[model samples]
Target: MDEMQLRSKIILTDRFDETFEQLKERFSEALFYHISADDFLVEHAKEVVDRAYLTSDREKVIVLSAKRFTPIAQNKLLKILEEPPSKTHFILMTSTKAGLLTTIRSRLPVVDMTSSKEEIQLTINLETLDLAQLFSFLQANRRIDAKEAALLTEALAKEAMRSGKYRLDEALLETFAESIRLLDMGSPPHFVLTRLCLKLLERKI
Candidate 1:
């Protein structure tokens, strides 16, 4: 087993297939149970764990990609996660680590695959965003959910800091970062965005 496969149980990755393929190469004899998106349920976790132990192979690998584990489901799998079969390995993949609980995160080492640059749709041109443009952008994105809001807030904060358009200092920058964290914790998107917009307006030079 590779050093990464030995230590990390959870992997936060964007290039899911690429990582899986690499694992397949390294552990060629390993039995792989790939549970993705919709297929990641409590029952599926049970099945995967059962199958993992059945193999008796030296290398047992389970790959989960973009699977949103509910609080209940996470609890159900906690035991298995805490103490899996000998020679068993798990790779939990997600676009963001926010969805996973701190309890689960504490048990696993994270392999962050998310890149530094925000997605194009999430990008904001801070230099050109006056009140009118900000309002227009908000109007266009009025229906975003908490996750989208979180991602947008992060991107916006980065743009604001990098552009230095508002001459944002550390305290103000931390406020923007806090807003992003709030969005991640399921804060109302409209309220979060509105407050962020108002703060940006106040500091706009």
Candidate 2:
């Protein structure tokens, strides 16, 4: 492919424009489709992928918001992902992977949005959270894949209850799991932390 042709394949979708500009520096050509979720747009968005794929030769890719994925849209994209055109690349980057259709998730090449990562809050008190507990914390407070995070968090919470150091309320355990799932979906850290702390404190011996 010629240099201009190569540049048109990359479709970057993110609130951060500067990041895309910097990312495009590595490639000579990329087709930029700037879109947002509107009632009319979502219904019409599938064409964007189709046109972008057909019109350009560099590669076929879709960058979409995790919270915005729909089953129909994903299934449509999954076809392209499953049987990629030769010399085509499909990269999907999302802050949360939980919303993606399982089929689409399985088919596409998932890449991290390195530009979107938030720095770990320096104020996170680590003195009390050992390795084992910290792992449980991440599992509980997942900002992606909250269902799995809830399961992991419950398992660890159960373990703590079983050890006899704390009381176990099954209902509260489930509630805590739900809170963790919400936190994964983009709740503020303070609210999540507060909910978690109250839950843990309730079971205190």
Candidate 3:
């Protein structure tokens, strides 16, 4: 490995250009493939990953900018991500992890952007939300995987803490933690979320 080679395969960043420039400087001889959102697809990933490296001496890097990778595309990429060709790397750039599948997010190491993170608005207030509202909310977020569910659980927990309406105690925190653990164990997203909500409802009682 060269002294200036990329230390990590996956980099999570909001400032795609800045990180990209740094990579270019580090791997000057490395082959670079820049794919925009419109250009990223399952076929594209297959084409790129299957091809032989242009330069054997240096690495090949694929930078996906502003692209929301579809589940199918990410799945197609999972094998190569786990085991890439001798000197190939992938850089995925996205504003948030919500759209990305849990499998992919877990694979990469996140890099902080130079700029502060943009605050994302909560679509529903979990504290005041009732059973009916919860179902409606879950309906809108259909087909989410276990990891995505865990992320959602963390977001809801944060919102609950900020709301100050519910009491945050050891039990509540433990339940939320368990929810995330269950997600990693292959539990269904809906079941895990629903169970977490029920446990949270206890705060009212």
Query: Backbone collision count in every prediction?
Result: 0, 5, 0
* List of clashing residue pairs for candidate 3: none
Q: Which wins on lDDT, candidate 1 or candidate 2?
A: 1
TM-scores for every candidate against the unseen true structure:
0.58, 0.42, 0.54
Q: How close is candidate 1 to the true structure, as a TM-score?
A: 0.58
lDDT of 1 by residue, 90-201 (tens): 7787655544555777798777656565463653467877778878888877898887777777567656655767856434554665575667578889889878877887
lDDT, residue 50, model 2: 63
Candidate 2 clash pair list: 7-29, 7-30, 8-29, 8-30, 8-31
lDDT of 2 by residue, 21-78 (tens): 5445644355444343411123544764565456566544333333244445555665
lDDT of 2: 0.46
TM-score leader: 1
Better of 1 and 2 by TM-score: 1
- Candidate 3 off by > 4 Å: 1-5, 52-55, 118-205
Clashing pairs in 1: none
The per-model lDDT (C-alpha) reads 0.68, 0.46, 0.67
